[model samples]
Structures are given as C-alpha cells and as structure tokens.
Target: MKSYEYIEEVKRANGLDTDYKVAKLLGCGQNKITQYRAGQTMDNETARQIAEILDIPVWQIIADMESERQKDPSKKKAWKMLAKLSKQAGAATYNLLILNSIISFLVIYYAL
Candidate 1:
C-alpha cells in the first residue's frame, strides 16, 4: 500500500529486524531509511542500490517507486522523465559495451 509498508514487508520477508539494518545493508544513512519509511521520492540510483542490497531485481524497487509516484499524481511527469532517461542511459551503456567488444576483437584479429 505505502512505501513504508512495502519496505517493512520486504524486511520481514528477508528476516531483517529493522529498517536500520536495511539501510545499513544498502550503505545509506538511517535518514534515508526513514525517508523510505515515510514515503519519499527515491531516485533511480537509490532504488537500484536498495534492490541490490535486498537481493531483488532493481525493477522491483523501481516499481515500488513508480507506485508511490503514481499515488502523488503531481509526480507523474517527473517520474516518467526519469524512467525514460534511465532507459536511454542503459541503452547507451549497452551500445558502448558492444562497440568496445567489437574494437577489441578487431584490434586482436588485425594484430594476429
């Protein structure tokens, strides 16, 4: 239902005793955990890091963030923009890795 509720659910699901433990595992401050508990707008990076710490897919965290954003209504545009940017960045990174692999292959092939 709410952000805090979701976090608490996950925390319990993973056998964690407190949100502070989750925050510490995430390498973030307890204030950040409090914000999560209070329902705050978490950026993509924070969501990703939290997901990693929680041993779940990053999309799950993003989905929770998206759900919270949708509830706010006013956050719709901003959330969409960030999602688009994250997608584009992921694509660009994939393309860069492919290009690098191709260059590396070519360099080795030509040298041999």
Candidate 2:
C-alpha cells in the first residue's frame, strides 16, 4: 500500500466519487490526487487530510503503507530510518505534553 493506494482506499471508504473532488476538499490541486494515485510521493499534510476525511488514524495509513514499502528490499534502509525517526519524535512529543500538563497543573494549584 503506497500513498496513492491509501488515498484510494480512503476515497472508497468515504464513498467519494472522484479523487479530484477529494483533492479539492483537501485544498490541493486535482493533479496532486492523480499523482498520488499514480504512486507518487505525498506530503504529510495531504496524507493527514485524507486520513481525517476517511475517519481513520493517520498513523494507521502510514503504518500500512510503510509495511508495504518495507517489502521492497531497496527500501529497507529508508524504512528503518523512518521508523527510528517516528519513534524518537513520538516519544519526545509525548514527554513534552506531559511536562506541559504538569506545569499547567502546578500553576493552577499555586494560584488556588
């Protein structure tokens, strides 16, 4: 499952008539949708929007496509790097959110 395939699946799941219209709704050019359907790379924003429109988790779509990409021997290195980066970023972001919540709680408690 490539980006295009994911987009197509989302469109189908949402009962969308045309990829062009999906692109329009996502605020991208129609050609972007066509290119995605043709197996071209998609930006993260577009991928997120497609996931949102289909009511699916963006990570689920990304994970499915990444799994498919990993099946190709040539992409193994890239896949590994991507997985490492995703993990690092996810952990860092979660930690930041936790820290922020703690700080916010402390501020409110001190004020009270």
Candidate 3:
C-alpha cells in the first residue's frame, strides 16, 4: 500500500479522523503525515509505530515501507511478498490459538 493509504488505514483502525490526530498518536508532526500522503516513504521507526497503532506485526509494516522505497524491481517484489507472508502468518497464529483452546476444552470435557 502507498504511504497515504497506509496512513488512512491507521486512522480508520485507530479511530483517528484526521492527520493531526494520527501524528499525535504516532508522535510525529502533522506535516509528516502530510508528507506521507504526498508520497513520502516512511522510515523504519515510523513504520514500527504504525504497526503498533494497527496492532500488526512490525515486520509487515517495515517490509511495506521498504517495498515502497525500493528501486530494484526484484527487491521490491520480495519485500511485498514478505509483507504478504507476514500477514498470513499472523492470521495462522490466531487460528492456531483458537484451535488450541478448542482442543484444551475438549480434553477437559473428556477428562470429566
């Protein structure tokens, strides 16, 4: 996703209605958000903060920002793939937790 789109997603996910609010949440200046909207690629620290705000894995955001900044097509593609895989991994982890809970419940029920 582009920086602007990413910022918008952050806003939506965190209930922030404006750039200023997002900046405050991220501990950045509003101009930084504006710069992102205008196509400025975010640094790693900013990406990390965004991940925290969105409750997502930091690597995913880092990869996304790197993909946006990368000039080499191959490297950019790799970064995009990394971001996609990380998202999938996060989902799988959630599913695994749910499955583990179900199994634990089943074991306890059978034990009784």
Model 2, 14-100: lDDT tens digits are 688888767767888988888877777676677678667765546655654565556677686566556456556766777898999
Count residue pairs with overlapping backbones in model 3.
0
lDDT of 3 by residue, 1-112 (tens): 7778879999899888989999998898999999999888888899888877777787888888889888999999999999999888878888999999999999999999
lDDT measured at residue 66 in model 3 versus the true structure, 0 to 100: 88
- The lowest-lDDT stretch of 10 consecutive residues in candidate 1 is 52-61
Stretches of candidate 2 above 4 Å error?
64-112
Best by lDDT: 3
Per-structure clash totals for the candidates: 0, 0, 0
Off by over 4 Å in 3: 108-112
**Best candidate, TM-score-wise?**
3
lDDT of each: 0.69, 0.70, 0.88
RMSD of each: 6.6, 6.0, 1.7
Q: Which runs of model 1 end up more than 4 angstroms from their true locations? A: 71-112
**Prediction 3 TM-score vs. true:** 0.86
lDDT of 1 by residue, 48-92 (tens): 765565555566557557856685665855665665566566667
Task: State the local distance difference test value for candidate 1.
Answer: 0.69
